[model samples]
Target chain A: MSASGYVQHYSAKVSDIYFIRPIKMFKSRFKFAQTKVAVGALLLLSCLPFAATAASLEAQLSQYAATAKAANPGFAGFSAARGEALHTRNFASGKPDTPACTSCHGKDPRSAGQTLTGKRIEAVALSVSPSRYADPAKVEKWFKRNCNEVIGRECTAQEKGDWLTFVGSR
Target chain B: MKFPTRPVSLGLLVLAFSALVFSRAQAGGGHYYPPVVDPVVKEECGSCHLAFPAAMLPAASWKRMMGELENHFGDNAAVDPALARKITAYLVANAGDAAGQRYSAKLLRGVDAASAPQRITALPQWVREHRKVPDWEWRHKDVRSKANCTACHADAELGYYED
Candidate 1:
């Protein structure tokens, strides 16, 4: 992006040295450059909202970590690897229709999934939708519903944390 | 292939009768159901499928369904207790048997609301309305689910059900 901006500025300077029609072309080029610069700024600016949510997401995980510590004296903390296993492994105890998260979410967390009713689910990977887990209420709602469906019970705080970590990294 | 005169005439009679009954059923032949207006209910219920019109079922149906969110048809759709209560209240209030839902009540014509029936699609009146739809239409790739009202009724989200 910066490289394109640099090239735009260089060409603009060269065009400025040329005459009448060149001035009009330079004006258009300058407008084009301005758009690129604004777009680049916007590209960087979009991360600001995600950054704010990133902090809140971390705080949410910390709360879960605290709960896990209370439940187990030797809690080793959340693990992305464990989260991945929990996501992929089919649990016999779970509802027959949804024995694993991958049953509906698919093997690729980065790709979309389809509900039994054929409604499309957005990709779960954080990289795909940076602000997905930003809303604590929505996050908790899905966790409550999905864990019960795929795990046959409410997931432990540790498991929730691990799952979040794994998916957030993706 | 004698033009199947008897069957064709019989089919026409059934069609004409339905046209009259359907008009009476939907109150002047409308296919609309007042969609859920409450944002909370819409969000919590509509996340997975069409937030079906509460007016399509009776109060008993809504009450029964809310009581079993843990096994909602096939998915664990349990919401927060308070939210569930709120949703139930809204649904029951607008249900087919509820006061002022006279038009919606037509859907419950032969149904025993006391049974607390669950499936809206299973409603006898609903079946009658869609009896003409081919099985292949329901199995179409984009129209895969019977829950996908919008697949045929483009304005289903807005409460209109005219195909």
Candidate 2:
């Protein structure tokens, strides 16, 4: 009916279409992106337990490998084959009851073994027990005790690394 | 004959009462050795063998064992000095010779308190109890060591060594 009234109505329509609509659309799209990021973070956090264990084992192996290298000038690296031999070999130097690693650990690394006192030992193979060798202190403690019982001495750094490598690959 | 309900009931009551008293006496003497309740002692000592009840050994025996952890049997079971102290305290406090532990008097019968015998299997009472077990059973693959009390005493972990 009037020029001013027509101009006011046109501007109101323009604001509704251009300003309010875009703000509403942007708000929904922003919420969708936030949901995607939250879900992604949750998935990553779930995988951290396995990843952290694997990284810890890797750290232990590297630490032992370094020690082996330092102990021997011509140290090449750890050998799984050497480890297997060490695992199965019998030596009379140790206690008569436990002359070899296999006496307690059994001949196969993948199978569970039994202690002389009748305690059950979980499988030492990394494939069977992924958490094995993740803790450096525990690994060293067992090596010390078992080597004395089976080999009659502390295990060398090379022997330790080779055993770790062999078990980890299995 | 007339019914003898009164006398029969009295006789049954006496029998039941005697049976209960006898069982309680038996349980208190042998089956009541408390298992290790200390988490530190259980983890440190039980990793290799059943954490033998402290009530099975004298305080002196536990002190000797704690002191000789570096050559535990044949393995190096040396723990940190602080942890060893804690474990030793627990063992000595609950030892067979401790006050109020009358059940272990029989186990400590022939043992010299000064000598501090370490082997539970070597105790006179233990030997007498297990004298019937054949040598083959001790040498069995599953029962390889005398330290393995659980091999035959299925409830040994629960502190019941009853046959």
Candidate 1 displacement at residue A119 in angstroms: 2.1
lDDT of 2 by residue, B80-121 (tens): 799999999999999999888765777788888779898899
On TM-score, the candidate that comes out on top is 2
- CA-based DockQ, model 2: 0.52
lDDT of 2 by residue, A1-170 (tens): 69999999999999999999999999999999999999999998866765776888778778877888888889998899999999999999899989999988888899998888987778989888876666677788889888988888999988988898889889
Query: B1-163 in candidate 1: lDDT tens per residue?
Result: 3678998899999999999897666663456689899998888788889889998899999999999987888776777789899999999999988887755655777999899999988999889989999999999977887888888988888887867
Model 1 — TM-score against the truth?
A: 0.70
Candidate 1 chain B TM?
0.81
DockQ of each: 0.40, 0.52
lDDT score, candidate 1, position A4: 100
What docking tier does model 1 reach? acceptable
Error of 2 at B69 (Å): 1.8
